[model samples]
Target chain A: MLNLIANENMKIYRRMRTWILVILIVAIVLLTGILMKTHEAPPSSNWRTALQAQTTQLQQELTQVQGKHVFMPARATAGMEIQIKKNQYEISHNIAPAQYTAWSFTSTIEQRAIGVLLTVFVAIVAGDIVAGEFSSGTIKLLLTRPQTRARILLSKYVATLIFAVFMMAVTIVASLVIGGVLYGFANASQTYVYMDASGHVQQMGMIPYIFTNYAFNSVSMLMTVTIAFMISTIFRSSAIAIAISILSLFIGNTLVAVLSSYSWDKYILFANTDLSQYVFNGPLISGMTMTFSIIVLVVYFIVMNGLSWFLFKKRDVALT
Target chain B: MADQIAVQIRNLTKRVGNKTIVDGLSFDIPKGEVFGFLGPNGAGKTTTIRMMVGLISISEGQVLVQGIDVEKNFSQAMQHVGCIVENPELYKFLSGYQNLKHMARMSPGTMDARIDEVVKLVGLQNRIHDKVKTYSLGMRQRLGLAQALLHQPSVLILDEPTNGLDPAGIRELRDNLRRLAREEGMAVIVSSHLLSEMELMCDRIAVIAQGKLVSVQTLSDLMSGGERHVITSFEVGDKALALSILNRLFKDHVVDDDNHPHLISLKIDKERIPDAIQALVEGGVRVYGVSAVTKTLEETFLEMTGDGIIA
Candidate 1:
């Protein structure tokens, strides 16, 4: 079994596709960093001046209202006017400086870039792990050796996981290096996350945020890898497996959105895509929790992998 | 025959849909014998070999290799058997030495010395360092043989071992296989559509047709008992008169060609050739040349299979 694993690892490491995937991840992360660094918000001078003038006018009106209420309107129904003035004051004071600065922008960009990169890379690597042997007519030679079919398939699965982890590490390292160089490293350790519903944000210290982000990203990536590998084994054709996996990644979200509008959305695989959405939300989304997503994903993983193993074990290795 | 049987198949039948590829086929190959499996295209030779190597499942029968049931303990049974079904496939990116090294690690008790021995056995010493992709077809075939023999397997099953080799390469392969069987006591089962090659190399041959075993006999037994013929030539004036006289005297004993005169052939018993010659001479027909024609393996194969060469 160890020998079989070593053989599978050699095949993956020697393939040109593996290197191509690694290089593509680094290139994409670097490109994301460059785009973020050169991005500006059209100077924002006009919007700032307009906002200042509005604030001054609102403050002047509040002062006049206060003077009137203090002098003669004490007995006259002044409570309603005073409430209006208080609302105006609250609005003006809340308009402080914008929070979407370079630091916050880089963090959001890195988070999204890493997610997309890991998803795509893991899907591709895992999808071709077993299917490629069938495509290339090597499976016949491999099975004829003194090794069980289950061992052979398991070795391929383990090799794919190793490849996924390697690619994720590459993406993480590249993102951090490029991000720190372009944007100052002063707040490098801080966790800056954007809330999806209200656009509210939070800042946390570096260690806790980085560890949590890594854990979440790793789990998400593993889910995609396992799913793709199962599809590859069930189909035994690299082209079909890869096409279905990538299409699922893009279309699964839409299906979830459509299903969520109806009553049956909870059963779809896409509904669990946001496994970590609860962590960033000030409060978790109603009826959706970390435990729920984890259970749903674990079920999906088990079913896909189980079917793959069954089909692969029973497949007739007919190579013409 | 040796006390140990290298391979045993009993009532083995493989059916794919409506077509039965191997039906009720049973055979036993004794230890240290070079057995030849001969058949035309689509004659279930490859299917039978695959069943022996555990590449395909046996539908209704059992295959035992070296006393172990193939279906029950395939890996353990396969450990004693080495096979090359169809073209030998190797990793194209790796060098010849690297390819052998990888396969050597799978077999128990194999070391670098054994690798070097097989490499030299296949006569690939000069180019074993080159990538397999750069080798010629014949070279690849040789390298495949090296890999098969790396484990020093007791039973070696090879399908079309000399498919794409030149005449010299074929001869070398024949000699090497004979040596393995004779000197090392390795049981070998070789499959090929070339009957003449099998006749030269195998101690025994099994002929198959339409997924059925037609016959299994020694090479001499199949070729020795057939009818013999003798060719007799005559030169004479008035060819028509001579032919008439000869036919009248040796009726039902001669075959005359009108287009080619002075040439008559006789298919008589070997012992009766002298008597027929004396009788023909006394009847006043001039005998020019007389010789016996050797029977070839091709005629015997055609007579047995009722079909011509596939190509």
Candidate 2:
């Protein structure tokens, strides 16, 4: 069995797509960072200049509505003037400031970019783990070995996991290095997360936040890998399996969002995608719990692996 | 026979969907002998070999290798058997040496010295370090053989081992397999559609057709199944008169050709060749020469299969 695992690792390493996926992920992350660095006026950034510009626009709208500077009479208005000025100040303050520098800008980009790249990397690695063997006609040689079919499939699964870990490590390390160089590492230790419902934002230490983010990304990556593996085993075609897996990753969240308006959203695989949303946001959407989402994902993982093993063991590999 | 039997299949059958691929095929290969499996295309040779190697499941009946049931203890039974079915698919990206080294690791007892010996045995020492994709077809076949022999199994099953080799390569493979069987006490079962090759290499042969075993016998037994007749050709003058005299003397023994008057062939037993020669000489026809034409293995195979041996 150890020999089989080693052979599986060798096969995975030799495939061109595995390296291509890794390089693609690293390239995308670095390119996005460079683009963000060069493009100083990116619309996503928050700067004081843009904020003041927006504040002026809101004041102009108010002037247009009343046809003049609407100031209350100081003596006869009975404190109405003070209340009106307070409301105006509140509206002006609410307009977002655009004091966007490297620290704030790179953080948001890194988070979203890493999440998307990690998801894609997981799907690519897991989707082709078994299907490529079928396409290359190597599955017959593998099955003819003196080991059981289940053992062979399990070894492949383990190898896929190893590849997933390697890819994630590469992506994370690349992001941190490029992010530090471009956006000076001063605010790197600050946790910038938005709070939901209460209209507030909380700041945590950077190391703990980054660790939490890594853990969350790992869960999502596992979901992608396991799901793609199951589909690959069942379909036995790399393109089809990969297409279906990625399409689900993109569309599944939308489905959960639309379905959550009704009562049946909890059962969908997409509902589990935003595992960090509740913790980062406020209360769960429609009173969902973290434990419930974890359970749902765990069940999905078990079912996918079980089905993969069953079908792979029973498949007749006559084509290979 | 009990001590000699290396692999035994009794009433073995396999079916894919509704079509029966192997139907009630039975054969016993003895120890230290080269057994040839001969059949036309799609004659269930691959299916039978797959079943023997525990690659495919047997629908009915069982396969016994060295007195162990293959289905019951496939891993243990397979430990004593090595096989290459169809095109010996190996990892193209891996070097020849790496491929064999990996296979050697499967059997824990095998050593690096054994791998070296097999690599040299296959005459691939010079190019064993090169990737398999860069090797020629003959070289790939030799590398596959080296891998199969890495564990030194007692029984080796090769399906169409010499399918695409040149004449010299084929001869080399035949000599090597013969030497292995003779020297190492290994039972080798090789399947091929080439009758002449099998005739030269196999000690015993089992011919299959349409998923059925047609005959199983020693090479000599199969060769001597029909009447042994010697065809003697003679170059003579006045072939009609010479033929009439020869036909009258040896009734039902002469075959005359109208195309050439100076040539005629007479089919007779070896013992009667002298008598026919004396009578032909007395007929007053000038005889130039006479020589006996022996039957080739091709003719025997054609007679057995009821089809032309070479298409």
lDDT of 1 by residue, B1-311 (tens): 43578988888888878879888888898878899998888888888888887777788888888888988998899888877877777888778998887787666577999999999899999999998889998898899899889988899999888888889888988998999999988999999989879988999988887788888888887776345544455555445666676676667877776677566666566777677667667766567766765555666766777674432
lDDT string, candidate 2, B1-311, tens digits: 69789999988998889988888998899888999999887788888887887767888999999999998887778788877777666788888988887777666578999999999899999999999899998898888888778888899999888978899889988998999899999999999988889999999999887787888989988876666787888888778778888888778878886688598888888888778767778878778888877666667666666673332
lDDT of 2 by residue, A1-320 (tens): 78777877877786676788778877887788777667755444444455455556655655554574565332323223333343343344442233233444444544877676677767876888789878866676566556777888888878877877787677667767777777655544444433432334345555566656767777877887778888898889998888888888888777877777777778787787668776675434666778888888889888888999988877655524
Q: Per-residue alpha-carbon lDDT of model 1 for A1-320, expressed as tens digits?
A: 77767777777777677888888777876787677556733445465566556656655665766777434443222333333333443344432233232344344544776666667777776787788777766566677777788888888888777777777677666766776676545533334333432233344554466556667777766767777777787778777777787788788777876666676677677777566577665223357666777888889888877888887777666536
DockQ of candidate 1 against the true complex: 0.44
The alpha-carbon lDDT assigned to residue B170 of candidate 2 equals 90
Best by TM-score: 2
